[model samples]
Target: MRQPPSRTAVLKVTAYGLWGGAVCSAVVSLLVSLRFQSLAPGLDQKLFLVGGGMALLYAIGGCLAYPGLVFKPKEGQPG
Candidate 1:
């Protein structure tokens, strides 16, 4: 039989996922900003959409990740 995941493992995975998301968001936002530099002159519309979508993804990821940090099983229970 397979063992349950540990709190430490869960936290580590969550942290990594968040870190990766932040990096990806930064890179993507930067690229989008650069791409629009000549045409839009500023973060007019598309950037907002990209930013908002990234924010939404982060929010959802955080919501899913936080449960692993907040809740843990007892010694006798499966994690």
Candidate 2:
């Protein structure tokens, strides 16, 4: 049987996934802003806002997850 992944591995994956999501969202937002020339400026602005908000949230999640991976107590050490 295969061994299950460790907690640190899970945390690392979570952190990287969140960061990757943030990067993807930012790239998509930039592409949309560049490709779509809407007649209404507000629409473009709203799209940017939504994308930026998502990216910001994802980045925050990554930041939170990273500490868990970095600050894990060593075996036999008091947390």
Candidate 3:
């Protein structure tokens, strides 16, 4: 198994990314709700689903890339 990155680095990076993703998703959802509410009169439910889905995707990407954030220095392995 590949070794993990330093815990503190992972936490800090992930936290910042998550916070940004969350704020972006919230703003998008709010805009969607307001823009489409006129057509459906109550589209918040769908807007939330879309926003949540996007946030989930961002989180998954962050998690997948976390391992590579700090590559392990292989002993005796040539670059």
Alpha-carbon runs more than 4 Å astray in model 3: 1-5, 45-79
Clashing pairs in 3: none
**Stretches of candidate 1 above 4 Å error?**
44-79
Model 3's alpha-carbon lDDT is 0.67
Error in Å for residue 74 of model 2: 8.6
Write the residue-wise lDDT of candidate 2 on 1-79 in tens digits: 9777766666678888999999999888867866664757677677777888898899988877774444653554321
For 1-79, candidate 1 gives per-residue lDDT tens digits of 9878976567557756875786677567767777786775566356856865785677567555654454543454432
Using all chains and alpha carbons, the TM-scores for the candidates as numbered come to 0.52, 0.77, 0.49
10 residues in a row with least lDDT, candidate 1: 70-79
lDDT of 2: 0.75
Worst 10 residues of 2 by lDDT: 70-79
- What's the lDDT for all of these models? 0.64, 0.75, 0.67
| Candidate 3 residue-wise lDDT, 12-67, digit = tens | 57756875786688778778877787677457778877887887777665655454
- RMSD to the native, candidate 3? 8.1
The candidate with the higher TM-score, 1 or 2, is 2
